[model samples]
Target: MKLLTCPLNGQRNITEFTYGGEYHPMPDHQQASSREWAEHVFFHDNNAGIVIEWWCHSASSYWFLAQRNTISDKILRTFPADEIFNQRVDFAPAPEVSSEAAPTTKGESC
Candidate 1:
């Protein structure tokens, strides 16, 4: 069995934690369209590369962030969510696109 290091609980069985999906910037609901909101709610990149994700320690009910590489399944580091955000990075509002700039297709083009 694999182990995942929790920021608050130290290293523990992977089963002791829950995968909370990739971390993403929350978009402004007032400016976001139905499609943008739906995409944010239902979609994930699932890319085969390093990604920052949210994880919860089931035993302590503590939530934190983990930076891991999906291809190697290796966790690089773990930290409390607030610690990561304490850097004061600004989350800018999503850029507005005109209808002419909107994609005509239903899905991403290869």
Candidate 2:
């Protein structure tokens, strides 16, 4: 049986982990176009080489990252997600509508 080491939980059965997908730098959400968004969400290289990916420990429900070799299907290492994403990301809030712009009723009410 194969084993995978969780940075927090130590080494455990491979079945105890779930593969989260290959890691890629995210495009600027505010600046990226619709096509860019779609590509980031839908496209993957699936290259045959060492790549970093996201993984989760099932029992703890803890998420982390892992580096593996696609050709050999070998897991090289694993670490917490915060190691790479040390900074926090904040999104701009949606614009508020004005009272004058409130929607009009479609039918007569009592």
Using TM-score as the measure, the top candidate is 2
Q: Candidate 1 clash total?
A: 0
Q: Which segments of candidate 2 are over 4 A away from where they belong?
A: 94-110
List model 1 lDDT by residue over 25-94, tens digit each: 7677568888998899899888899999999999999999999999999999999999756755455688
Q: Against the hidden reference, what TM-scores do the models get?
A: 0.71, 0.82
Name the runs in model 1 displaced over 4 angstroms: 84-110
Clash number by candidate, in order = 0, 0
Error of 2 at 71 (Å): 0.7
Worst lDDT 10-window in candidate 2: 101-110
Q: What is the C-alpha lDDT of each candidate?
A: 0.89, 0.91
